[model samples]
Target: MLPESHASPDRKRRPFLLLVLVLVALLGVGGYVAFQLGGDDRAPVANEPAPETDQPSTEAYQPWFAGYTDLTATPVFTFETPDSESGRDVVLSFIVAATTDACTPTWGTYYTLDEAVEGLDLDRRLARAEQLGGQVIVSFGGLLNDELSTGCTDPARLVAAYDEVIDRYGVSTIDLDIEGGNLRDTVAGERRAAAMATLQENRTAAGTDLAVWLTLPVSPAGMTEDGATAVSQMLEAGVDLAGVNLMTMDYGASRADGDSMAEASIAALQSSHRQLGMLYRLAGIELTAATLWTKIGATPMIGQNDVAGEIFSLADAAQFNAFAQENRIGRMSVWSLNRDQTCGSDYVDLTRVSNSCSGVDQGDQRFSDVLAQGFDSRPTSAAPIKTTEEAGQIGDLTDDPATSPYPIWTEGSTYLADTQVVWHRNVYQAKWWTLGDLPDAPVLNEWETPWTLIGPVD
Candidate 1:
């Protein structure tokens, strides 16, 4: 999740006394709490406590599950570590531009796709994981190297490069972890969007589909301006985005001093929900709060973050997991599977971020065990990719009031939140007070309107 340069042996330690004070506050508050980072000069960040809601009786909430694996890290991950949970999906990262050819893709800068199959035995390991009921989601881009679009100048070759990786891996879902310079390059963003749209369309025409997820960096304030633009570009290009995965770590100065990593993450997700809703509406789509949650995903940097004094401990994992389950978020992921375990005794400094070991004291726990607690579903189970023509069928249907269970929606009538109405033979509920917004509008994005499609009236 972080480049090599971001790691340093020198970092300010969180004072033990301050930590104890924060723990005492948490005990008294009896809900989600935020703690100040000791030695941090930034102002203390404060986040509202998580709203209280009745906890679900059963562990039935199942979001798609995957944990990132750094493909080029030392002590190579074989997908069979003893700490790994059975049937857990792994997101192999990253497929970046080859040093020799910008259009050629490699697993980080280390191994070509075919070379990895032979050298790393990647193909066999993937098969073994699949045999055990696990799936793979190939992640492209990263903090270090050039993502395909950033370096590849030609449009045709960019699309081909992505296609080659997808074809080689035989994966349906792909994550684009656009960050750093890649996120800011508007031209690259457009090129990436266009290339993905073309690739998706070509695949659909050939009787297959691609589920693309934009993995962008975020702060407690929500998505950065460039990130929102990247998403907007994707929507404008007619790409049916699977979801937006937030990199909920390394907040830097954006995180207030006292805010716990989990609290900051929750605040980021909530803010992003509102921002994404507005973006979808601008694109003429309306999605329900529930549906929007499914279109959002969170990936926390487990154990220690790149920024000094920001540690995401096991307790934070439990709190974040509960929030994800309560909100029914679509996906849950960690920054890496490589750093899931505790550091060995030889490693002296626990504050320094490491590529191989988590800078924490894990008595006998794995980050995946806590983060992937209730997320039992596979990543491939995400909503299917729908073509524009397929999505257009909603507008062609007519609603008959005689058979509709709810009142037929009228443009002149004001509807309050939770008001249900019939449109195009389907039930829709208003997310908030609105008048004149069509429930059955021919919109491409779900967040474009104020109505949420419940289901077809039987």
Candidate 2:
């Protein structure tokens, strides 16, 4: 079901808004291609040079994680409250590099989790954390980590693996990080039901509290107004959801703002927190986690463009503290800190984070300490505002081969000009492009054009 907010008679089934960049307008096209080609949620985006901008001060945050660290090897590090603070909130995240068995990718070649894990040497890290009584977790999948996608989407296969992890590692929870991947032609409900069934089955077999966490996309800060409808569609399908983790980093892609990266990221994080949390409530769900990233890249390339030489350093520690204090969010999960540049070598100093990073007493060392303090806080009323004239509506092109992939306004809407709809595949949603810029696009023949179908044109 669409969120009640969008289910009214006046509303149409469409996304909240579209960030249609002319140069990167191809981004939407590429996203559709990746969606169709990969088949689930694992499509790849064309790597392009990111736009440039001045960095904000050390206080703000941006949109997504440019890079991450896997903690599959050593598990334990003790974090303490800073000397002057009484209590501070925290968020700790860990990624699973890989498993031992081979899992086939939906599109690409097959690879084993062992390949990823062995290379990263994360098991020793996990064991170390276990010995020290630190709460080390295992995150499954990433932007292109396709193996887990193969294993996790299937109920039977997922159940077997879930049992093995519990027995072998005594892990009580597992996180699923599904980002740009595949999009199937299958009905949305069918996909959601299948995924949810798998999660429920795996959880039942594990016998412990099994958590399934998802990291979602947020364009810069709270630019979710554009994607809110799409998100509602996802929830209706049943993706075995537990909570949402907003990858609140890299807002504006940081091309324009060079100096104030941290401050920018912080502001974006706060806006994203408020906006997304409101959307979740309007759609009826809980906001479980709010996390930040260590750094963001300038382009789609994996590691080439970092925002600044060093991101979120101790100099910026006060920024995070202040932001968290204002938002009342419980924990702050910094994207894997292992990638941060230290005195000479790259090392993630978790202690540099907040008043809680300094060494503390043993009794205070628990996973609970990592939670953000304001998890229960929320606004009593929805933010007041005037709705956009262009409320939620699907793109002009339906991509349905049954009809010409041309832009046709629905009965309730008006068309200013003819539109072009491109169809890429069976499962693809139609794409719309304005005819204004296309030098050779077919012009709408008003005299012979069908009237009611395109709606009464003004």
Candidate 3:
């Protein structure tokens, strides 16, 4: 049922503080990832494989990407992950433009048409992303913004605004994210048709090959006959309709009922997946992307906890995975990654080679004691930084911010990031690395886990 050791009740749900120790041991301490530090200015670099001598001869691996933070366009560095088909593969993250600031409509104020278009016009944000499924479409509506649907309801004005956004963002596709509205309203059908008409008009006027898409509500009640008919209207509009992105979260919000965050997320994904399948069959339209959940943020309907752990798990299920696998709809785009905590969950450890056993395997007793003693230390070593390949083979990089001021000193090491040193395990096979010698050890952020492993090497 659980993915691996990750399923253990102790590992999955340990005391918050103790869990930090285990995770730190697994990931490492104060090692800033190459991408996170580079920020928005970073650009895509041609991937150069490490030389044979440097890259260990191993089996090949499959590479799946993680989406980058919002507002960030380029990937800081491509890293390797363990793979079954291949020993290793590179996963490329596609970062898109998500307006969480003034673009949000949750607080009562809605962005005007001009402001909405301008906010979504993030250059190089989605422009240079590696194409997982053609152009990484710039999504318009999300959990925050309601004006895109409310204000841009006019056929002519909406078309013009749509054109401006596509041209400005240089995106080949668009995701129409109109969420949470009753389909029985008087203007519901007209409003949706007008929206589709705007997309068609924009496509023709811009002369750019554009795919118009909608993010439909997943529940049966959310998709009444009127709602399903509105979706069919888009097909008749002669626009190259892409696919519906299921709003696979916030299922309980319909009834205003309370449900576990995880269960709500899974239910939404399942409901949307089932509804979309039926709609496609009845409407006789071919679908492109089976994407889910347009955004992830602080709201109860679409929060961070359910988005990553629960929603993603549903995405990986056998049924959905098969559809995605077979149909080339392999892309899973979260509306914004910036909204998520860089440190991820609270269970993350923030300490260096110290042995608190947060998430890492603990074999060294002394290392654990040292971590507790110098808990606030930093790595002060001057050794050359190892490449990601080297880091993977060697011991995990430490994430402890406390060790930021110290150097990383290896006590008994088998290998330190591709460099063979005199480090050896004890008679009982205990191993350790000293933080006193590592230079450029990461300084931990309050929200950051000191033991979180990062950087290209990690």
- Which candidate ranks first by TM-score, i.e. highest? 1
Order of quality (TM-score): 1, 2, 3
- Going through the candidates in the order shown, the clash numbers are 16, 67, 69
Candidate 1 achieves a global lDDT of: 0.71
Error of 1 at 96 (Å): 0.4
Give the TM-scores of the predictions, in the order they appear. Answer: 0.73, 0.44, 0.39
Residue 417 lDDT in model 3? 39
Candidate 2: give its CA RMSD in angstroms: 16.7
Estimate every model's Cα lDDT from 0 to 1: 0.71, 0.30, 0.30
**lDDT digits (tens) for residues 1-458 of candidate 2:** 00111111000111232222222353222010000011122221111001112222222222211122332213322222221111121112223224444323111122233443464434564565445434433444444434243434554564455445444444544444434331121232234335544655555675434544344444333323323333444454443343344444333343235645445445444334434333443334532222111111111101111222323343344444445444333224444322222222232442332111212222323212222222232111111111121111211322354554444323333334333222321111113333222221111111112221211111
Local distance difference test, candidate 3: 0.30
Over 350-455, each residue of candidate 1 has an lDDT whose tens digit, in order, gives 7778877789988888878888877776666564634222123224457787888999998789999999998766678888998887774433224445777665
Better of 1 and 3 by TM-score: 1
On lDDT, who's better, 1 or 3?
A: 1
Residue 249 of model 3, lDDT score: 38
- Which scores greater on TM-score, model 1 or model 2? 1
